[model samples]
Target: MQKKTDFYFTYPPNLQELDLATMVSMYRDRGEPRKAAPGKYLACAVTHKLLKEAKWWFGLYYSQAAWDELLTKGSEGYPLTEAELNLLGLVLSSETPPHREYVEKNIGTLPKLAYLIVNDIKQFGFLQEDEHGYLRITPRGERALQGISRRIYQKRFTAEMLVVYHESEELHRDDDQRNDQATLF
Candidate 1:
């Protein structure tokens, strides 16, 4: 039978320095059958894109700082992945025109991935190509980058707090160990 929990977690500051994997492993059930699910995972294992609802579910009121910050801000447009944000930030900081080749050199990604990210940025209207094939960030792109930066900061900060909060808990060890086990609430 599945158990229900109302385990409200609050993240703490100084969380970036903590060993999240170890902390998470501490709660692991070592000997039983694996209970992890494909799409479900602990918050620290941020491998794929996470749902926006996560911000509300795991952060915010659970982490008071996140909650206060949430009240002080409004949402931005569609979120960008880490790669997307990195490309945007690079373009925004460029003193000279950055072409696709330049991005590959600086961003340190495979050429194909760099091409796709550049094109994606253009599709979002945050970047443009000049007659010489140089890339430029538009005014709208600047605004978008700003919004993305803020969004990323909020997510990271809140996640840190959530980890710290969980670290203080007195959790029991069980035998079921799964990385992506969805919580059945």
Candidate 2:
């Protein structure tokens, strides 16, 4: 049997005044790339879950663009967490804007947890609140959920079901427009 390992994702090393988390948030939320040194990009949509993965960077030199291609857009990365997807699914299932109270009550997730997820959803422009304070799914949100559905429907017969990428890159170039749709391995 293969020795299976669980991998976690995080930002690349940022050789700057800002801390790693802040730098990463800026790059991820603003969609900007920063070059830490010549031929080495520190933070950007192009590179992610970086540096630490380089346990032995002796010969693991790659351009910023290439790194983005491998990690961010490559076979083993996804930008969204499961919580965000769940919230999106809830919103899509409703014919109208689902109230936040309803979502909280139905899911039984703590209000704080639900708030954070909804905040992330709003930040990504996936879902928006109507004037009446009900949560409505945006076109982008629909597309994200639909994209997953479509991919699963197409790959139903196959053994591949690990990766189902969100449709974010094509429309929003500034925030979370990364090429990573799903994980491959």
Output the worst ten-in-a-row residue range by lDDT, candidate 2: 156-165
lDDT of 1 at 106: 50
Measure candidate 1: CA RMSD. Answer: 19.5
Q: Give candidate 1 regions above 4 Å deviation.
A: 1-77, 154-185
lDDT of 1 by residue, 37-129 (tens): 567632322223332222332122112233234321221333344445456666666678777677654543444545655776787687898
Q: Candidate 2's residue-wise lDDT over 1-185, tens digit each?
A: 11122121222333245654654454444222333455553322234434312221212333444444333211122333334445666676667778877665443244444565576667768788877769888877766654433333422111122112122232455344343443322
TM-score of each candidate?
0.41, 0.41
List clashing residue pairs in candidate 2: 46-68, 165-181
lDDT of 1 at 101: 72
lDDT of 1 at 36: 28
| lDDT for predicted candidate 2 compared with the true structure | 0.45
